[model samples]
Target chain A: MAQAPVTTRGRGGRAGTWYLFLVPALLLYSLFVVYPLLTGLSYSVFSWKGTVRDAFVGVDNYVGLFTNEAFRSKLLPALGHNLALFAGTMLVQNTMGLAFALAFSRARRGKRALQIIFATPYLVNPLVIGYLWTLLLSPTFGPANTLLRAIGPDELAKPWLGDPSTALPMVILITTWQWVGFPMLLFSAAIGGIPAEYAEAARVDGASSWRVFWHITLPLLRPAIGTITVLSFIGSMNTFALVYALGGSSGGPAGSTDVLGLLFYRAAFASGDINAVGTASALAVFLFTFIFGTTILLNRILRQGEEAM
Target chain B: MTPRRGAVMVPLMLWGYALVAMIPLFVMVLGSLRPTQDLFNDPIGLPNKLYLSNYTRAWTEASFSTYVLNSVVVVTGAVILGAAVSVLAAYPLGRRKFTGRGFFIGYFISGMTLPGHFGVLPLFYLLDGLNLVDSRLGLMLVYAAGSVPFNVFVLSAFFRQLPGELDEAAALDGAGPFATFRHIMLPLVRPAIATVVVFQFVPLWNDFFYPLVLLRDESKLTIPVGLTHFFGRFQNDWGTLFAGLVMTTLPLVILFGIATRQIVAGLTAGMNR
Candidate 1:
């Protein structure tokens, strides 16, 4: 389409009104987002006691984040937990989500109900999801334990969230259950978009269903897979409300479910001191850099994969 | 991908997963309906009788009524503020071919995927300095700002797709740019705006982190944050909490059920299309 010439937009001076239209959203967005982003960078290098900055600390806060025992202990483990959560989603969320998507796309009946059912868990607050699951997984007066006891041994009904080893995994599964709907919808739509001819032709060639899925369906889903992977990575990394609800702000049961967002909260607000603010700011900056860089790298890889396909 | 033939196991697996997935929610509904005593005494058994008191208790004693009101107010305000500004901004970028148009579009688009949580400290201080930290209007502003990127992104793309004859026809009819936009263009983009709102509603409604840290007053808190405090206060009232949870989630579920097709379309709008 040819560009609409400027003079055609208005009789004479009215063309400038477009700039007027841009101001409200731009001002709100800039003041809230662009400005703080810059300030966050500067704040990372300075000590702040609540709203007041006390001293400039160069890279000391960043250094301290990696060195200070107070943060170092939590930071590494939190990072590990984030990665573990990502891995778990890659396993559980991806596989189940794809299966659900495939099934939904194939089924001739109740597609609307299936979509709604799959989508319900994700519609509520993650915090609420955490709370609901907490009640379900409660050792006493919880149906999950009762069912486990009746179906298996009494030992099978052990506290799900109370134990350290199980806490993180439980959180991961709950996270998966809450989020799988969205990616599933995406996958289902993508699968639906694929022309049936490719798979039909493959079937005519006597290819097994697995063979057709592997070569035709999976290859066609490369973009969706890449997009979901990147999004899931970011989602897991930024997770806080779920962890905060299931485990306390400390990410407890022994800090087994601790993650970067919680660590940021704990560091920033724990003392409300100037140095703590600086340290938290430093961590934020680091997280920003890490996430931004990795996403760029991932985008590049995705583009390359698409081109290769 | 469709296979000509499939095993019975596939449908069985799907149905099994669906049933298992519904268990937690079913349990929540049952817990809400039955008495707390029944919940504890007959953990795995049927409810002896229906007890509607849990909903009333949660509504009155737990203060979820006020919290829901606050949530509705904030979410509606944010959606309006976000949508209004986005529509205005998108028109200029989408319809006009002025200088630095690309720059402005790029600026809004840059924030599309950047999570704004990392700037909490700075943002808090920014709002505090502006005296907006604990205010409802402040929360609305923050939510609005957070949504601008996505709203502008989608809305602008929508605006760009309109036929150029629209502007020409409006211009010939002696309508100025603003008048044209208000009368002609606005009516056309209603579906896109609705789509944006539907897409924005879920995240905005479900957001907990920002409201928790930003708002301080008890009555001012939204449902998610308020529910946490309610849980703390009524630690052992599992039935009441379940009622609160159902109250919080049920309306949304019902809404989605009614508008399932539109919601699904809005959600999958970013996919292969």
Candidate 2:
């Protein structure tokens, strides 16, 4: 912690230069991100239209969010839908991402080509992904139904986005398609980081590939798995575009896909009822707390594992 | 080592999933080539003959050329400004032993956990107060500000890993702090820079929330919002929508193709350390 010799102008000048370097970022961040965030927390306590001055009602928004029938019915179900989406993504996208990563690790000839192909869906805009899938699942012209009809029975080819029961699941599937590759890349890097020795040692003991993966590779890839899981959980919870595009503002077929984000958008902006903006901000606060807490817990568990190792 | 049968199955499973992943892209291209009636009628089938006019029609109808230009300007501005500020802030945080450095680092990184939309309502009013609503410059500032925390975190970590001997050697050569950073440090962190560029660029290019809230003028809308214009109340024009979707997705696909290697390398580099 000894300071280096004063080779530049002087300590004062160096400190001044440092402050100069920091100014642009600090100023912008303070003006946009930090200030707005603080103001949002303050706004959550008040009711106002764009024209009228806000009146603070201190925790009333939070109280209403919990007690009101409309909020309870709408908000609770939307939270469930968001959780379902997260669970679906964990099972399907993360699982397949891990599988692809393991395979890509061993691929020799077309590794680069295969990586590009697998990553293509992730690079597309979410709006496009939503639209493309909407087309593919359109009851009239969508190829998904056509393929289902061709391969299976006609009974299976229902209007995918139209049916209330199937609509949210369909949106989750499309989002999974677009996002699976991100976890694949993360898992590949993680699986690659596991030193070759552990796997080799397991194999030397007459263990099968599955055993090696279960006993050695899985244990070693814990950090990456934890990181991706936490990140993806937060992401799926914050997700808005796909659901908005596929299910619309109401998040319908009877509000099936009305996740927190879409609900916030509608309540705050779409309705033009500025009083509801406080409620929307309350919801945003709830989401931030939920995800942030979960991430911290996951990180702690991972750190504990690292220490135990 | 014996080539286990399970290892063979792993590749097969991966190949199968890879095929599933590519199905949408293939279908998109196919949809772009077929006429509207044909697209609906034979949604699962290949077109009888490819229609090349879909791209042209999509481009003209959606005003995608203007959207693309707007997107390019916004993304480029975000990357350049974001990277410059992040690097400058990160250098001092990484190299200097100043008091409150940890607190500052933690402060910056905390922004990453908070969703940008959490502050959207207030942000709208703030930008409005500054007369920056619907302006390209406003969007650029927002993007850069949002990206700074993560960029600084990543760059600082990369900077910390550099050998101290190199900094001392540069200092011994009469290189001032600026010169040492310019000559010695910058070259060493090329991989980190590449990672930051790709990471920031992709999200900025694909961003929808800021533009949706901030920009009301249809002429100034970015690609994602512009493409959403195809979906109206009564019905969605499926053919034109798919065509527009394909057009918007193509540049990203191409960009990913070219930078795929660097992306993988850069991402792993950050994760590994």
Candidate 3:
């Protein structure tokens, strides 16, 4: 890893060619990714509507995003829904994912078929998946209602996506269904990478299965857990297409399924009022800050938890 | 984590979840084969006769044919443009010890963290100003640009794994840097390039956001966007809708079935290692 002397570079003149190689990617990335981000930050301050800048309103847009009643009622609850998604998925999906990983790691029967079948859902488009679930969960003609009725739980066969009380939970479960394989695979890889010797040694010491998992396996899987948490958390926070496809931009079923991404879209595009652009930009900035800050905070907390263990 | 001695519940649980995953897909396929009335009455049952009219209706009346063609074009364009650029960029970053190499690598990896909503409005204006709005080429550009960071990130890592001796040998034989990349280095990293393509292809084909915002023309819509419009019009036709979903998703399902290992490895490549 030692650096070669700078004199080596001066004689070669290959540095120019190296920069040539970097330019295409650098230019494309800056144009689409970096430049737009910086532009969005600046646009959050001004009273602009699409292309026209009206005035330098300073931080008024940010202030309005908080103080405005319409924005508040939608934004705050939408954020809550996102948190609900994160919590629900963590409890159900990750737990299932870990269980599947453990099962696949141990089971001798149908492992490959199970892996392929489990992972298939993650391969399709999220929008398509949302639409498919919308059909499956339809109250009148959907199979879910039929199955529930057949199982003697006729009361359980309600309009899953149409009722405000159930819409968010249904959407959350659908989201979990699409992505459980991701965490399963991630945990499987991490679990697979654990040295067999460590587990063998623990077993030789007469450690019970439950005690071994609690003491050795879970602690060693801290990094994987941390990764899945941060990823699943932020992913839910920024989710758009699933809710948009299933519930529409208004976060339908009377906005029970409302999320920040849909809120941003409704603010920016659905309202048709141009001045809402600045407010939407402000919301975007808030979302960016929240995602970035929480990622850093969660990673730090996970690191500390690892150290404590 | 070791496999514990108590294995019965975990395996049963895994199989149960696997069934949960497969059942919906099974329903989708089965429902697609029935007429609308049959599906309405007997959604969970197998079709009495395989009705093929729903596929034709979805293809012709729903206009998924045009959408599929458009998606194929955009996905092909974006994957090729992105892969070519990534190869060129990853080569220098991975092979040479240039000034600002770390900075360049960091610059590319940073794209992974960007939120989609953050700059979408600004990007809309940017594309509009450039007069690329409502055009396939414009959408392709956005797709290619958006994909560059991850492609460069993955490909550069793959490129770095090549032995330095190969580059030295190529240079010793009077292969210029460009020639070394085009002839010597590119062949060694074909698998990574395929990884980049497979990774990029699914998202691009599945993309609805860019086409929703940028392409206003009906002729230019991708499958996701196109299907939404079709669904809105034929909201009551459950059979046709199911057929449309199957056709739209079948290619990916087939691809995954054929290359499950490659797709999974390509996807989880950076996550673990």
Which prediction has the highest DockQ against the true structure?
3
Q: On residues B1-273, what C-alpha lDDT tens digit does candidate 1 reach at each position? A: 344335455666676777766778888888898888778887766556878999999998888889889988999899889999999999989878777889999999888767788888889888998999988889889998988988898888889899878778777788877888999999999988887777777778888888978999998988888988988987688899899889888767776767666566665665423
Predicted complex 2: DockQ:
0.49
Q: Clash pairs of candidate 2? A: none
TM-score-superior candidate, 2 or 3: 3
Chain A, model 2: TM: 0.89
Q: State the weakest 10-residue window (summed lDDT) of model 3 chain B.
A: B1-10
Error of 3 at A173 (Å): 1.6
Isolated chain A TM-score, each model: 0.92, 0.89, 0.90
Clash count, one per candidate: 1, 0, 0
- The TM-score of candidate 1 is 0.92
lDDT of each: 0.85, 0.79, 0.84
Docking class of 1: medium
The stretch of ten residues in a row with the least summed lDDT in candidate 3 chain A is: A1-10
lDDT of 2 by residue, A221-288 (tens): 88888888788888888888888778777887889889988887777777665567778888778777
What DockQ results do all the predictions give, each relative to the true complex?
A: 0.55, 0.49, 0.55
